[model samples]
Target: MQGAQRNSLRLLQWMMAASLALPIALFAIASTISYNSTLDIADREIERTLDVAHEHALKVFETIDRSLAELNEVVRDLSDDTIRSREPALHKRLKQLADALPQLKSAWIFDANGKSLVNSLASPPPNQSFADRDYFYSHVDQSIGTFIGTVLTPRPPYQGARFFGVSRRRSSDDGSFIGVIQASVLPEYFESFYARIGSDPGSFFAMGRTDGVLLAQLPRLDRDFRLDPNGQVGRSIAAHPVHGLMTIAWPTDGLERRIGYRRVAGYPIYVSAGLETSAIRGRWLTTISQHLVFGLPATALLFILLAFAFRRTQHLQLEAAKRREAEEALKHSQRLEALGQLTGGVAHDFNNLLTVIRASVDLLNRPQLSEERRQRYITAIGEAVARAAKLTSQLLAFARRQTLKPEVFDVGERMRSLRDMLATLLGPAIEIVTQLPAEPCLVSADAGQFETAMINMATNARDAMQGKGRIVFTVHAATSVPDTLAHLSGSQTLKNPGFICVTVSDSGVGIPAGQLGRIFEPFFTTKQVGQGTGLGLSQVFGFARQSGGEVTVVSEVGQGSTFSLYLPRAPADLLPRSPAPTTAPAVAGSGMSVLVVEDNIELGNFAADGLTELGYSITLVDNATDALTELVSHADRFDVVFSDVVMPGMTGLDLAQAMCDRCISVPIVLTTGYSQALSQDGIAGFELVQKPYSIEELSGVLHRAARVKRVRDGAAE
Candidate 1:
């Protein structure tokens, strides 16, 4: 037993040593490799710096060459016989050319005798002769038409310092020589270029001409336009023709630098760049050292603690795994709850769509052909279309696709408008009463959605009454309620601060006690399947919640049901409500050409035909793609583009953008069956008409569109 114990102890010792030793050995090797790799990278970076300097020098030379070429062209033009014959015209052209050339400080033309003809300066010297100047005399004999000579300041009216001259001898159509046209470009332009190239906070660059004259230097040129020739970098560059790099300790800052240099291939200039090596690599080295200094001891302690804590962690991990399983189950339950609510909302919208279609078809089947009969049929179709629009709206609401156009509207006014509809919808047996405050009770919400919710709740109440009870609708302004009932009804349970409340009550069969909890569970209904899809209460719940409020029901099986809705109140100043238009205005077509862009072939054709019949000229296109093509090809042809908002390939918004890109200024009227898609951003500067609109609505939108187009066009003119 003693022998076996000794062997087991020995094996454990070996295992601990092996685990700890491996990482330490690997870390040492890794640190060595990293240090060497950083050195190699530094070398490559020095090479790159040299290449960059060389490229910058070449660019400077190219700028000089281009300036010379431009100057030569101008000089040649001034010396032409055609320009000289028209002396006044020639003077204007010279001034214009001088103003255009940013690199040249000034320009001048001279006769063969070197008398100044025109100078860009405000005043010209009485007599200035450049006949003895090198630029003129050197090119005087050569067949070469142009020459870029050594820099020399021009005589009076142009002189301040030496300038590079580009001179050309001009010949007329008969090959007779004309006076010399010379242009001088200032050296200060090249100095500015060098300044920009070396503007980096840590860098400086300087250039020397082929003859060892410094043309430009950053940190400003000295009196002789030269960098400190005795400096280590300057001496090295002047001595070596081959490119070179070296790390030097900057004398002033005490920071190490990587300095590099290369001679520009075609130019006589040598370029140099220096970057602070310590600034670039010091931080990284310091970080590595910090980790190494602390890590060794920390790692040793961690290994010891981990071995001691192993058994405890094993027990805790088991418990944690079980807890995670419980959480997953809870999340699954939440998902099921959300899915149930969604299903109910979808069913409600589908039923509403079916109701509209059924009503419309029934209207078309009317047998009598009297004028009154035809009018009634048309009205019925209109009502059905309005209902279908409501169905799509509800679908969008359920999907969270609808954007609310919140405006302050008086709750009382909206309720008053529905009184007649309420009477007919409730039938003769139910007594409907409205109790509203004389003062407006206003709330911020989409007026249409709010009205629809009210109608839905009223209809549900009427059904529950079974045609023989009194229903009361009341609106009031209220303060916060206690949390107890608030929690029960899921009312804005936090704190109302203040609110507007609308309540609808029916004295009839109330919801069962057991089923009250599931009243908003969409499709969970006691009614016959064909009688109702059970989305009424669900929609009420969603709409109330989405509008920053809540809907609550208080019911007793034998008594009655009361459904109260809470809405956040609007400020007093925001309470005004616009009255609904009492009657449709006379339909008058604006005399303007209209382009109808709709992807639905039948709908597009119907709209075109209908507009034509209403006395408006119409052009029809199937989609935004074809519409854009037509606009591009014939931009001035259309006055207004009446387009469906949602189409395949390209949306109406895309078409609008394309028109703007092409600078085609025309009014656009966007129409859609899906009003949810016509949010604030979609309707900027354009008129929006809901789909299934009557001829009157179409004409109204067209008139508005035409007026807007005229105003815009007049402004342009």
Candidate 2:
């Protein structure tokens, strides 16, 4: 056991040491590889710099060649049929060519004896001769139309006017050299092109002949340069004939450089653009080192921390255990936030309902009210109660606690019904457009859920437009879902042959591409705080899924957004559609007995007193438990058993089910302010009266239950 304990200690020590130790070694290995990558990237940047300089140089070379060709033709005619009388005209043309080609230092003609015959500046022909000039001497040996000569140095009396020129030999028809027509160019022009590359003092460009004669360089050369194949520029040109880039130390200056070399395609001239290699590499290394410096300390610190953590593991575990204890509290806080949002919407809606109810009641209390106005007020109260009940059901459905009540319905008709409310909510700036079909496609879905989903979609569209744009609601029948619509909503394959497609579109600032996928997520609104709780789209998603449908969206930055909802079409042999309800006269009950079972004492008293006032005898109980005991004792006393769906013990639905099991005959009526029981189990074999209903609606429901009981009893007899 002691040996095993010693091995365990060794293992723990290895675990603690290895955590940071491996990373430190790996970083060292990576540093070498990273250094190479940095240099490789630097090489590409240098190559790009060379490309720009090379392009500018090529254009300059082409212009010089063309200018020399044009100037040669003018010079060839200077000694022709236009003789000494045209010397003024010839001189004028020469000066014009020199001025036009800014690179040219001068344009002139010199005879075979090398005496200046005509000069661009109209200076008298000079007595001084260029008989010994290398160019003049080259014409004596070589038969030529145009010949490029070595650099000219002014000799004897001709001094201080140095020129680098390309000459055209003025030869006779017999091909004997007459003289040379020279277009002399300056060295300073190449300096302007070199300055734009960069301000690195070591970087420079040189113009040299392929034979390795440095004609001109931008930090003007003190003496001519000739490169041997063994050196940098020559080696680069030898490897890449036309264009090349390479790095090597200069034999003359002893400076190491990354040089770009290009040979003038048809000429002996070569241009080399060079940058000192160390300058670029230094910058790259500095940048890379900065990154490494920042990360290396953090890495080493991490290694030290891991090694130290060995001693603090027990303390960390205690902290982790404390964190686990706070998990439930965090979850409770989240639930409270969701509850707050739910209550806010519910309170706002309930206030509107109460306002309608209070207004109607206040109007009814007027002593001398017209009969028409009285009936209208009653109708208004009934309509508001029905609306409130449906709204409550929709909230429950959105919460995923209610079983959907699917009915065959037309989407177009529903959209038409919502226009008045939507217009009022959207305001004058927002134009509502409804392009529904004359005969809407039929789909089976909970009417309340469908209405809620439509309203949610409209609300989102209004918000997206910032409350001022066109909102288009379209309803159409589709044989199958298109691929485009499927991407935003669901699969292309329709389970049924066809579907009822309802689309809500708006011309507004559309959703961003990144946020589109998550818009349906609960509490993820892009709206400002307090403007929205982010539950609108979530509720729409819930309603669509619960009703066996789906919702999709398509949008662009400026174009706007479209939301398409696809619901499975109802079958041809769908059940007979229920006719629309008409306002029925509120008739008082004929002393009908009602057993009112409610958990809340205040609610129970309200129910009992309302029934008593409605010409019905009432038997009240605080809960279903007491109501059940009373039913057992006096089973034949009540004509209708009325109870709230939700209770402390034994719900109204449970009591109704128990009565069915006991073979009781009284008709049951269920009611609630808001209860999942009505949605989950449903009001089967029972009348349902949603809460916040008027006295008239309650009277209607209680009487209906009594009638159902009386009819059943008569059938039994």
Candidate 3:
């Protein structure tokens, strides 16, 4: 029996070892796959950056070539004597051409003997001889079709700024070598343009000749630098001929980079661009580290639990139950943690706004305050209140309980109108690209909130790209939310509806995988402190869910991110009709009798006094019960009921229902700071004006409600 027990122990030991080994092996395989995938993604990004640089360089070269050709036309057949005769006209023309093109430093027509004929820099052109210049000699043999010469400083009588010439051979009818028409291309011009594209550290842009002479480079070198004929760029150009990508150590700094090189279509020039390999590897390492941070610990814990269960097979069921209980407790704690974060974030923001108002009020209360300072303080107070209101609105949005005024409108039209506004907001550095379909994509949603959500998403994209890169807005129809987002919270609304998907895609440093799940959570941001409030995406998520749809995102670290906002489609019949313009007199209380139901004494008094001032005969009550009693007893005396939604004994909605049951004819208008019932079920067909309303707003709503009541009573009569 003892020998059998020893055999069982050995068998259990083997099972535990095998279980741990399996998971460890699987982990190893996953890491390997991830590493290779990261490298591939890096390569693709390098190639993309290279393509942009190549196109920009090609345009610059083409501009210079065009200028040279235009200059060639004028001086092609002109003899040295004739050119000198028209020297003043040629000089003015050259100056105008150079001024027209930002890339051109100057334009020159060199004589066959290498003497400067009229140039753009000076009239009665300087007696400079370019016969000794390489450009002049290269064109002497035969037309090389716009030869791109090496970088060189202009000789005496001109600025020392380095320039490379784009020269065309000015030949006679016999094809004899005559003179050269050159557009002096400023290398600094290209460098300045490159600086605006992006400035990621360790990233570089370079233009070089096929023979390996460097023309210009960003992160400009102090002294002229040349590339070896067998260097990475030269070899890559020779091997691929047109465009390709490779990894190499930069000759000047010895920093390794994943470079993409492309040869200009009909020029000997090549453009290369890349980010340092170290930066790419650093991003990869961060992703791997995040995985290990979570995965390793969880794996170890899992292995421990399995081993413990194997050793205590008799108590396995009880242990399993305990483990389940622990998991439940853990989930509960996580929920509490989220709640705490929400509460803390709200409190912190509200406190800041309140502090602003409080300080402004204190300053205003001083009797000796200057007129300018008083106006400033008042303005500050108003702004603070506005900010506070916006914050509460955002919080309501996150809770999916904000009161929205939905209307059926074309989404495409709205975006078209909003594009220019967004362009101004994001600034000139960021490019806004649109892919709106020709057909109108109509939806029933709050147009104001829709614009706000679009702006929020665009602002987030701008931040992710560090104020530069592309923000593409694509609008299309989707039968349903993507399957990948079907399991996300608040996505059930999108399951059975045809939706319009508005996608915002950005090419920026992307979100980390671990943080993607929590990005929409209120007040949770990846941006550094003071940079973001983290409520932008939360509002987006809330708006989508509230509008009967969902927002989904797909991101990859180092590649960029795309956010898809789905909004339910409106039926064709729901399209809004434009009503004819009316010249009716402005709405006012006009002695209309109003029964005001407000629980707060001060607020009730304010309403009563404000309405009285606006020509309304007001009856104020503390609760819906008293208001209902007064209204039922003297229903004919009051023309309208102005009531707060939340009150003691009976709510405003309940009071409205009671009045309806009793066959009361008074029109009821409801107001609320916030009400879950009103937000979820709406005002039950009653006119609603939000809380802290102006006297004008309250009077207008009251007069409109009374007018409708009068019209209905007259019709019944």
Candidate 4:
């Protein structure tokens, strides 16, 4: 019996060891996987950075080549009989071209005898002959359109500096060699252009010839006119493709580096951009060290603690749950960071707005205020209120809780009306063009909000072009819409239901692709300080969502941007419609009875007071239950039921449904600051007024509601 007990103890010891070993192995595997994933992300980030640089450099080179091509065409034209006969006229034209093109140093014409005939410079180079030059010899027997070559020294008249010559062969009408028409571009010009890109420290940004000659390098470089083909870099270029990225040790310094190269198309030059590998991996190495400092020790300590608690099943389960819990914590941290950023920016903006309001109020309280000062204070108060209202509207839009007053109108007519306003706003430098269709393209949306978005777009374009460019507004009816969406659902839908698209296009610097996803985020501005509020696009987004529509943008850097607001089409109205009135006679309210239901005590009191002051009898209640009770108890006392849409226990929508079920005749008018019912289209059978309504605005809406209520009461009777 004692020997049997010893065997059981020995078996149990082996089982315990196996259990501990399994967890240790899992921890090791998980750590390795996490490290590799992080490394992959770092590599992707580096590649993306290289891509941005490549695109920017491409644009610069294209611009330069375009200018050079323009001159090349002119030089080709100079080979004609009419132009050559008027040598003086040709020289003047070449000088004008050189003056316009900053990169071109001088332009000259060489005769069939290789003698410099017509020179662009005021004082022409003396006794210039190119009989021995490669450019002259190369083109003497050929008809090269745009031949590029390097110049080492002045072969007489070229008497200034080492430069690049972009030459075209000039030929006679009989196809005989008539020498070369060439333009000189100094090496310093290309070097200065590369210096402006703000490359990293110790990394080289260079423009080199395809023949392995480095023409220009930022941070200064001096080398022989021709690079040695026997060098390591020359061999690498020969071994690699025209454009590529490579990681290798520099033969000159023995430092490991990552290099990117792009061969210019239709030219003999290429650009190389590189960064030291050590600099790229510096942050990654730091992260690994931090993991070693904290992660390894914590992992070991947790393993030991688990060993002690091996007998407890609950403790093991708790440890198992912690992995998922940590994942959730990481997601929560990201959410909190975004929230924190928004709140911090909003706080600063609100403080500035409040300072204006506070100062204006203080000034108004003065005992003997002059009329001018009082007017100034009042204007200041009005402006501050307007700005605050716009700020709140933007915040509500980003949160997808904004209220929209939708109406059917011709978007084309709206753009026509805005042309003048946009012109003044964009100033004299920007031209405003409207492409309005002859027939009406009608859409259902808040006309005011749509107009605001147009104005915002115009302003943004003005800034993008530094107040000099063109803005075009195009209105059209689209047969097919790609989607309709609220913020959370990234769902896609396709249909031919159709939509009215109002596109605002600008000939200005475009938004970066990386920032397109965040352009609608509140308080996120690319503009300089004090130039913008960053709420413009967000308000447009909010209006689109609230009105059951969508917005999209297309942009390319250096090209421009286009913002399209697509609104679902309304049912086509048959009769000719009257235009929306800018102003209407004020409607005063009589002693109409109203029941106000609001959850917040402060807001309820404020609403009650405002209604009473507007010459209406008002009764206020807290929740939907209390509101229902009041309506039932005193049915005949109230003429209009005014209720907030959001409430505890029973919501305003639920209460509305209950009233309908019970067959109550009184008309229901819903008011909401924000409600899920608003976003999901739950307020179907009532009129609504957005928050921050004044006594006059409230009175107007109340009078309209009372008329409908009276009609309902008469029908019931």
TM-score of each: 0.41, 0.44, 0.40, 0.35
Per-candidate clashes come to 0, 0, 0, 0
Q: 350-397 in candidate 2: lDDT tens per residue? A: 788889889999999999999999999999887877777765654554
Which window of 10 residues has the lowest lDDT sum in candidate 4? 487-496
TM-score of 2: 0.44
Badly placed stretches (over 4 Å) of model 2 are 1-387, 402-408, 414-431, 444-456, 479-481, 485-497, 511-554, 579-582, 586-591, 598-615, 621-626, 648-650, 657-663, 694-717
The whole-model lDDT of each prediction reads 0.67, 0.72, 0.80, 0.69
Q: RMSD of candidate 1 to the true fold?
A: 35.4
Ranked by TM-score, the better of candidates 2 and 3 is 2
Model 2: lDDT of residue 287:
68
In angstroms, how far off is 292's CA in candidate 3? 2.1
Report the candidate with higher lDDT, 1 versus 2: 2
| Highest TM-score against the true fold, candidate | 2
| Residue 379 in candidate 4, Cα distance off native in Å | 5.3
Ranking by TM-score: 2, 1, 3, 4
Q: Which pairs clash in the backbone of model 3? A: none
Worst 10 residues of 3 by lDDT: 331-340
Q: What order do candidates take by lDDT, descending?
A: 3, 2, 4, 1
lDDT of 3 by residue, 528-619 (tens): 87566677788799989888778999999889999999888876677667554332443557678889999999998998988787688988
